[model samples]
Each structure stands twice: as structure tokens, then as C-alpha cells.
Target: MNTSIFSRFQTRSHGGITLRASAFAAILCAALHAHAAQDIYFNENTSVSSPNRYLNESSNWYTDAGRTQQFEGTLSSDYNGIINTESKISASCASELSLNSLTYNIAAAKDYNNYFASLADNASITLAEDFNVNITFTPETGWNIQTIRMFHNGRITVGGDFNLTFDKNGSGSNGFLEFVIRNDSASAALTNRFQVAGDFNYTAVESGSRLRFVTGIGQFFVGGAMDIGNILWTINNPSSSEGANISLGGLTGTSGMISLGTGMASTMTFTNSAQREAKTTIGYTGDETTLNVTMRASDAKNGYQILRISSGAYGATDANLGDVIIDTGRLDLGMHSGMKGNYLSIAGVDGVFSATASDSGNIGAATFENGEWYAGKIAIDIEGELAYDKIVFNGRFEKTGSDRDMGFEFAFDAYTMRELISAGRGEFILEDVITYETGSSMAGTVFEGNTSGIQWEAVFGDTSLSVSFTVPEPAAVAAVLGAISLAFAALRRGKRA
Candidate 1:
């Protein structure tokens, strides 16, 4: 054969028979042409989302869910699939499947039902576009609350973003992302990951949305800002580096409340500023409905910060960390072994609001280990109020470090300081005597009681460093008291009846 002809002629073995490369290329093209881009619908679809669906079943799929347009091909990145079933437990074999998008679309004109979807073990899905959970309803019926319950024993990778936004003129909807791991060693693999390449923005989702981790080694990552509304994030995984983690790029935007609870040890980290300035309440991740809140050294294991400044995880500094409320839970900020649960890690706490009251002195709201909290480039504020009773603080509230100091302030109702001494605010816990590098100390006759608040200028006489406190009023105590009173009155009325 001539050199030119030989260059075009290559050998390939098919069924033990040699074939020219041109022939192999032609056959490959035909195979590739078989699966074309489509907006495919699962056969389980209905006007009112019902019936279950299978992701791996080919015969159960059709071109139209409402009509009999059977589709005879498997799903691919070139196709867009819809899961119109009320509940979807999709499983893929050992192979990887990538699609344009997946929607848990339960057709709605009636009251909303909680749609469910999860991946079985070893199953994986990659949405090349976005994973959207949407609901449509009439505005006159008010906000029709639609919810989607998410579960994962396997994996789901969203190429774009994941959102549960309202349809039909923004009626209303909420999505509950609960990680129902088997809590067994065989299930929670450290390598299991459920990631969103783009923002996991739930600004569209209404308040009271939840994302709880019962037990799972599946780590979740969000690539963009997490502008979610009010949310209560519960982390109940055991203490381990392999435990589940929810990572976010930034938590800016919404001023909605943020709450956290940790059972064993798990860390929820964010890369940049946590500057939403929302109210954060720390509570237990246990059964809040049936059991009462309890806090002890043993029950509170050593874990990292609830909203651990992931700047340190990525680079460093939650200088823009936001507001927090310790209303219904216990915060374990003690150092166990060499790692101090970064509850309010000094190295990253630009804003550590230690606000409290004296009513519920029963189960001290927050607990801290005996350690120092450094003020990065920003000042630190520890503000609290007082009643007739003492404000409770568990473990030890001691802190003093030679670390970087911007400044520290203890703005408290000093008049009630004497009453709180027995509960443990004996002295301004951050530091009794503000010592400067000049070997000089300042505190005493500044404001009132032991907590007169400290300033960089007052300590080192350096007026450059500024510190301020936005002392949140102690309404939590009154709120608790009112609720208690209401409950007692209701009981009395019932007994009379």
C-alpha cells in the first residue's frame, strides 16, 4: 500500500476480525447518534403527583408522562428528565449518569404534599444544568405550603445550583433537606459527597426551612453565597474527621434567624464573611418536640464552631462573622485535647456576641472551655443583662491569651453583677485587668462593677483600635417565662373542664 493510503488505513479488531479505522469510526458515530437531546419525562408523572418512579428503569419511562409517547432510550447529559412521582427513590447501577436537569415536579392544583426523593447506596447523578424543586398554586388560596423532603444514601452532584423556588406568581414553598443516613458504619462513607457546584441559595424558600444531619459521612459543599432565610441547622454526627460537613462559600444577604445544634462532633464551615448580622440561636439537635433541653460536659462533646469560620478552613478569618443567640441550646466552646471547640474561636471572632439575661439561670445557656479568645483585627464584645437572679455559665468562663488583641468590652448591667457572681461572672471573664505591652493595666473605676468594658486606648492607650457592643436586650427570658405561664394556665383550664 502507498504511504498515503496506509496513513488513512488503520486496523481495529471487532469480533476478532480486523476492520479499517474508517469503518470503526462510522459505526461509533451511528451509536452516538442514537441518543439525542430531549426533555424526557418519567412515566410516573400525573396531574396530581402520585405513583413512585425508578431512575434505572427504561420501560417505565416515556416521552410524555400525561400521554402514551414511549421513549426507547436511556437518559444522558443530552437529555432532561423529570420525576413527577410523589416520592422518588432513584437508583443508578454502578455506572455514572449525567443529565441536563432533574425536577421533583408534583403537578399541583390542590393542597401541597411533601414530595420525597433520595438516592440509594452506590447511586450517583450529575445534573449538568440545575436541580430545581418547584411548586405552583393560586395566590388567592394564600401561600400554599409545598415541601420537598431530600434524602441521600448515595450521591447527587448539581453542575449549576439547587433551588426550591415558588412557581405561578411566587405562591409559596419550602424544602426540607434532611440527611437520613443509616447511622451505621457500613453506610456513612467518608468519600460520599453531595455537592452543588453553584449557590445553594434558598432565599426563595420560605422561613422555617431545615437541613439536619442525623448521621452521614456525606459531605455537602456549596460553591456560592448561601442566602437562605430563617433556618435551623442540626448536626448530630459522631466525633470524627469523617463526619458530615456542610460547607458554604459565604452566608451573606438575609437577616433571617439562624440556629444551630450539635450532638457529637461535626463542623459547618463557610469560606468568607458570615456577615448576615442575623440572630443565631444555639440548641440541641436531639428531640426538641418530646424532650427538654439539657446540657452537661458529657452530653456536649468537643466539636468545632457551629458556624465555624471556614476562612481558616480555606485561608483564614471570619472577621465578618454575624450575630448569634444562645436561647434554647448549649454552646460547647471548651478545648478538649489540643483542639478547643472553635465555638467562638478567638482567632476568627471579629464579632462574638455574648448576650444573655438572668431568668433561666437553671440551664446556663452557653458553655465555654478555659481558654483565650483573640480579637483578630477587630474588637470583641461581651454584653449581657441582669435580673434579680444570676446568669448561668457552665464549665469555666476564663480567657486570657498573649494572642493578637484588637480590644475587648464587657457591657453588662454592673449593678446586677454581684447577683451573677455565684453563677460564674465573678470577674469580666475575658480579662479582669486589661494589660498593655507597656506593663500597664486598666479596669477598676472605668464604668461600674467588674465589667466596665475595655478599649484598646484604655488598655494600651492606643486610640486606634475601636470596640463597640450592640447589646441585644434580654427578651429571651421574658419570652420563656410567658410561654411557661401560658402552659400552666392552659393546664389549669383543662383540669377545671
Candidate 2:
């Protein structure tokens, strides 16, 4: 550990100088090794373009329906045992009842003695049917009939139907009468008394199913499996903090925008999905139009952007944040091993790599390192082998603004009809075969392998692929050390003299 040995040795002219230069060279080599071990670099000139801005857009949208309702206190009367019931009760459920059945008092006049009363107790009572009768409670005051109690049930279930009412007319003095329908077989019973109030929510699923309340405040439409309660639709009521919230299951096949708010300005959730063929268009009222064309999930796995148009064929301006547009071309999923082409393409997206593939385009496995960043992972099928390639992150540095437009692209080879049929194992399967004319000499085949001589070009724009760095070269560094050593030797010799 004699640090001065090297310095003092430098003072020795001939032999010592050579040894000092050699030591300095060793230090320079070590520094070079350290610099070479870095991963990821940022090129300031280019930026990572947002992955095909339409990655989530599609042609068709999966849908589920629901409904909800709220009622306020209201007063109405039931006369002649006739209840005016509303028709067409859709998927509507009430939480509580404020007002159930109504009560009334009637009087029988004159001498209406021998009489009978009728009562109809049904779940739904209609005013079209009527019943009337009267009874006498007289001779005591030598006057007219005073009052009779009229009772009605809100929640009623009936096995049969009958008329319910009270009447008096035959004789002079009025008679006391009341209609009573037993809840034994076919009649309504008494239940809670509550009125339906507030707003009602309704959501459509398979097709056209609607629930009409007084006024609808909000509704929700989820695209996948879910558990629903009495309330069909729900909206995220951030203000109240107790209302319903909508959940999106997965990407659908069409483009759609969910809007929340009143008047012109509103918040929106845009989505789309495609099956065989579809068209999805989305945009704000004042924004530019954008459309993405894609294939079904089945097609995507088979190495085909079924739609001549692919996702991200369009650009994203400030107006396209929650807006998605897509169009699904044809059902040209070749008939081979249930193989269908996929048109969904993603570029310049950073995060965990999650993809599953089959056929020759299957991704066997992938490795993530250096912060576990998979720069670009593309799956394509060649012949019968699934080929997956992920660019390893060499290195990275500080960044500002948007992500760079970094991605990989592959060109496919053309195949003849005969080759496609034979390659698909007797199933007509073609990969990346477009009927339209194109610049590339690639041919189209219903069932065949991808084109040859295809090279993937990594697109780097706005940002540098490698981080900005400059390590001093060994020659330059050694020269600096040599000069320092010379200076030190002269100073030491001068002191010694």
C-alpha cells in the first residue's frame, strides 16, 4: 500500500516512465469496462411514438343491460274498488314503498237495507272492472247513512278476480255497506305503503329492452360478465359518493364512447370490438375524425391483419384521448386449425409484456431484464414455427416529454393458391395475403407461410436508442496521466536538489 512508490518511481527518468504509463493504461481499461456495462440509452433527437393510438379500438362492442328506479311521495285515490294499474312493467325494482294502498270513507243514503258489497283483490287492479253495493245501519237515529270504511292493499296477489265497491239507493234511509274481498284464493292483500320516487335507470343488453320511469338521470353499460343488483344501470356519482359505477371487462370489437354529463360538454369512455366485419367511428363534437381497422381475436393469432387497414393507421391529436374509432373488414379467417388473422398492432408501448399466441406465430417464451423492459416483442409465424422476438434494452438515460416512437416492423412474403392450400394441412390458410395491389413483390396465399427475406427494422425517432454518454478513450486518458506524472516527477526532483 505504498502509494508514493508509483509517484516516486515516476521521478526515475527512463524505466520509471514506461512503468507509470503501463499503470495508467490499466486504469483506463477498467473505466472502459465499467462504461460498457450500462443498459438503455436515450437519443435526444427522437421520441417514442405512442403505440398505435388505436390499440384498444375495434369494430364491434360487447354489451350488457341493466335498469333502476326511484320514486317520490304521491297521493292518489282508489274508487269503486278500481285501481288504475300501469302496463308494460320492464326490468324495474323498487327499494322501499312510501305509500301503498289508499283508504276512503263512503256513505249510503235512503233506506238501502238488504244489499251486498263486492271487493276485487288482485296484484294488478284495472279500473275497467267495477262492483257496487250497500248495507243499512239505521232506525237508531231515524236519519240517513253516515260513513263506511274503504280499505285497499298495495302489494296484492290474486288467485281469482271480483268487483269491490259500496252503494245505497233502494230505500229512504241510507244503509251502511262495505266491500270485502278475502285474500284466500284470488284477491289482493295489504302490504307496506310506499310511493315510487326519484330517478330510474335502465341499460340494454342483447337488444332493445327499455324501462321508462318519470325521468332517467343516468345509465351504465358494461362489456363483460358482472353481478347486478335491482338497479339496472349505475353511474359513478363522485359527488354523492354512494351511487353506481361502471366497469369495463375487456376490449370489445367495436368503437364506442360513453358520455357523462349534461348539455354539450361531457366526459366519455371510448371503446370498440370486432368479430367478423365491423365499422367503428369516434370523435368529439369539435375534434378531428379517427378510424382504426382491425381483425377479430381469432384472426390476430393467425398472423393476419384481416382488415386491409390496421390499428394506429391514424394519429392522435389532443382531441383523441378518450376517443376510439375502428372498422372490421372481412371474415377471411382461413379455414385451417381454426386459424384467424389478428390485425391489432401495438408500437412504442412501455410496460409489462403480456401476449399469448398460437399457430406458427406463437411466442414460446420471453425474457425481461434491465428494469424488466421488453422494448419490442413481435410474434409472427413462418412456415410452421412461431417466431417471437423481443429487443433487449441496451441502456437508457433521463427523458422528458412523451415516449419515443420505437417499434419493429416485418414484411411478409407472398404465396400462391396451391402453396397456401398445401401448407394449411388441407385447410385454406393464408397469412398477410391482401387481394389489393401493393408495391412490394409479396404475393397472397390463402394457406401458406410468411414471405422470406423479411427484415425487422427498429424505428427510432425523437429519442436516441442509447442514453447520451461519452467515456474518455484509453489513449486520451493515458495521455493526461502521462503529463501529470511528468509534472509530479519534475516537482519532486526540484525539491530534492
Candidate 3:
């Protein structure tokens, strides 16, 4: 054999072969280093203030000035910074946005109220809990809660139907009061409804308590038991679509005052010809969805014009109303007979043609014009293609034609949107957003964002408007990829050497 060939085949006694293997490994690692530099990792806690950094660069996308109504972007923040959970966005006259998912640490004993209250805007807020979450809203006469899972202990006087549900926390031992409308008194005009679900025990908090259930009108003297799993009750009023539908499963504990109708009548009417209108629908069934509406109606001969339609708390006047109205075809209700009263209605609409999947908060194209009023009939469509089993809403309350001269202006006060998506615990997503007064009431010229009837026009002219979103921190993704590459390279080199 040739001397050189023999040398090539000869094993180096000084571990030359091992040295060669090491060099090859080193070269492989160097090549991996070049590739691994591209990997990235995204942190939810990463604070990004600039729109360009979190949006424009790789996440946010927007349209031109002529189309400023359209935009899409993704944001990252601690879970508590956004919504309480996987809740839907609250839509009002003003449009808003929210972060759907977030990451952060949560201790079981921490108060989540601050986090939840912080996100109250005209947008959807969601929080991902890392530990047992406990929240208290405190106790207030209007709206307050001291402890969740427990109803207020005092004589809770509710003018309107009060509904409460405490899942795992409510064990049947507790007691609560329920008030419903009764017609026994000829002067008492029956309006409003009440219902509760679950394997819960309900007691009459008051002896002379006027109560009405799915059955009929009667004074509730003792507590009642409800087991929605096998029994369901629906208090329906043939005169109006206002009633209670209660359904639930499992043991539930509740105690407190259950007041029926708007708690006070001084500012309201409760008699038959008393010009009274109040309704509530509360259900404990994990799946039983209910709709409620309260309107102030007058005798038909008085020229009935709708003043407001709201999901919650239709304020004193219509001039500065803030409610969510669906974007559908023009709201044209030719000619109807009724008196001067505020009306609010809710129904289902076409989900596919109306909204895109994965999208939550929505706006519509209804405009104000002519002496006649047009209002969108709202709906939460669950019929077909847009079959995410999601919720959709369209609300309209208008007064035009001759009734435009009504003195009081519309004022929309409170708005909220809540939904329970998770299967366990009180793992619900709730959006409670409110908009500050615009400093101006519904008045002035028709096209200047107001109509003769103080109608609120679209903030953005074109109704074909929507908000799009994108994922931020593309670098983080690159970091993760690079780390993965480095790990693989290390393993490869270790095996090769």
C-alpha cells in the first residue's frame, strides 16, 4: 500500500481522530449559531406603548384617511389589564377595543375588582387567571357588592326584578327574598317578571312581600325550591314580551331582598293607567339565555315615539344616550300607533352576512333623517354560517315626525355585555364599559351628529367600518425559533462528537 494511504487509515495514537470530530462539531455549531440568532420569544408582560412598536410594525394594520374607520392590531399585557375573563366587548354609540388574551400571575387571595373595574370602557376586556380569583364589587344602593357568591344581607329593596346566581359558592343553606308583580290590587298595574334556576332554596325575605312566579300572582310567605334540571318556569305576560325564565342545575344558596319593578315609583308609574314599564329576565341555567327590555309608553292617541332602547340602565333623558345599536339596514317602522314613550327592544339578526368570525364588538350603518325615524331591530343570530354560537345585538330607540318636541333629552347611563364561556366555576367573561358624556346633548342640525329628535349619528360616516387586529412582538416569535434551533444544534454536535 502507498505510504500516504496507510497513514490516512492509521488511527492517531495522540487522539487525532477525536480532535477531528471536535472540529467538525465546532463548525456545525457555528453554522447553527448563525441560524439560531433569528429565534424569538414573546412576553405578555412586555410593555409596548407606541402604536408602531405594537401595531404598525408587525401587528397593527389600518386603512387610509378616507377609511379611517377600519383598523386591526394585537396587544400584549398582563391579564388584569384587560377584561375580567373571556367576556364580549361592550358596544355603545362610541366604538372601543380590547385584548382577548393575556398572561400574568394571580394569587388566590388577590382582589380582582380593581383589575376588572380598570377596564371599563366601550370595549371588550378579558383576563386569564393564574390562580383562584376572588372579586368583590362592594355594597351600594344602586349597584354594589360586598362579597361575591353572597347576596346583600340587609332588606334588599329592589324596584325592578333582581336576579342573583352563585354557582359553586351558593350551597342551599342560605336564604333570599324574591318580589314579583301581583294583580290582586286593582290599582297595582302588573308589570315585570322574576325567575331563578339551580338546586337552590329561596325564601320570602318579607312577610307581606308581593311575589309572582311562572305560576301566578300571590304574596310569598315562605321560601321556594327550584331545580332547573327537571323543572323550568317561565313567567310570561301576554300583554308584553316582558317576563322571567328561570332554569338551573345543582345546589344554589341565595338570600336578600328581591324587589320587582324599578325599585322606586316616585320617578316611575306602577298603576295600570300609571304609564309604568319595567321588565327583567334572569336565568340560572348555564345555557338558558334571556332578553329583557324596559320602555316608557303612553296611550296610542298621544303619538307613541320610542325614546330609548338599552341593554342596561336607560338613563333619564334621550339627549345624551349611550347604547349599542346594531348595524343593519335602515330602521324604518312605517306607521305605528302609540303614545310618547321610550322603547327598547332586542331580537336576533343575520350573523353571517353581518359579522365576521373571531370579531366581537360591532357597529352599524343606520342613520337619522326625515321626520320619520329608523331604528335597527337587534338580534343575537345563532342560525347558520356564523355558527360560533356567539351573541349579536341590535338596539334602536328613535322619536321623529311630530314627537320631536318632547322636552327631556335622552341620556344613556350604563351599558354592559357579559357571557360565560368556560365550563368550570364562575369562569365567565364580562364587559362592563361606560362612556363619559360627550359634553353635548342630542340637539342642533340633523347632519352634525344629531337630528331633530336628538338622534345620535354614526361617529364614523361610512357604516362599512370595522376594526382589524394583528399579533405584536414578531421578534419574540423569532427568539423562540432561535432557541429551538440552538437546542437542536447542541444535541447534534453532542451526538456527532
Give all candidate RMSDs, comma-separated: 20.8, 32.6, 28.7
Best by lDDT: 1
> For candidate 1, lDDT tens digit of each residue in 125-217?
788888876544344334333322223346678888877554343333333333233223445445556678777654333444333323344
Give the Å error, residue 78, model 3.
Answer: 70
Q: Which 10 consecutive positions of candidate 1 have the poorest summed lDDT?
A: 289-298
List the global CA lDDT of all models.
0.41, 0.23, 0.22
Give the per-residue lDDT of model 3 (tens digit) for 135-241: 21212212111121101110111111222222211212222112122222221122212222111332232332212222222111111223222112233221222
Error of 3 at 167 (Å): 26
The true-versus-predicted C-alpha distance at residue 42 of model 1, in Å, is 1.7
TM-score, cand. 1 vs. native: 0.47
- The candidates, ranked best first by lDDT, are 1, 2, 3
Candidate 2 lDDT over 1-497, as tens digits, reads 67753574453357444567666677779987654411111111111132211101111111111111211212111112211111110010111111112212223223321111112121222221111222222233223322111123322211122112322233223222322212222212222111111111123321322111111112122232221111111111222222222222222222222212112222211111223221221222223322222222222222222111112211222122121111111111111211122122232232112222212232322111112111322333223322322222222211111323222222223343234445655333222211212221111111112223221222222222211112235685688679989999999999999
Candidate 1 — which pairs collide?
280-325, 283-329, 311-316
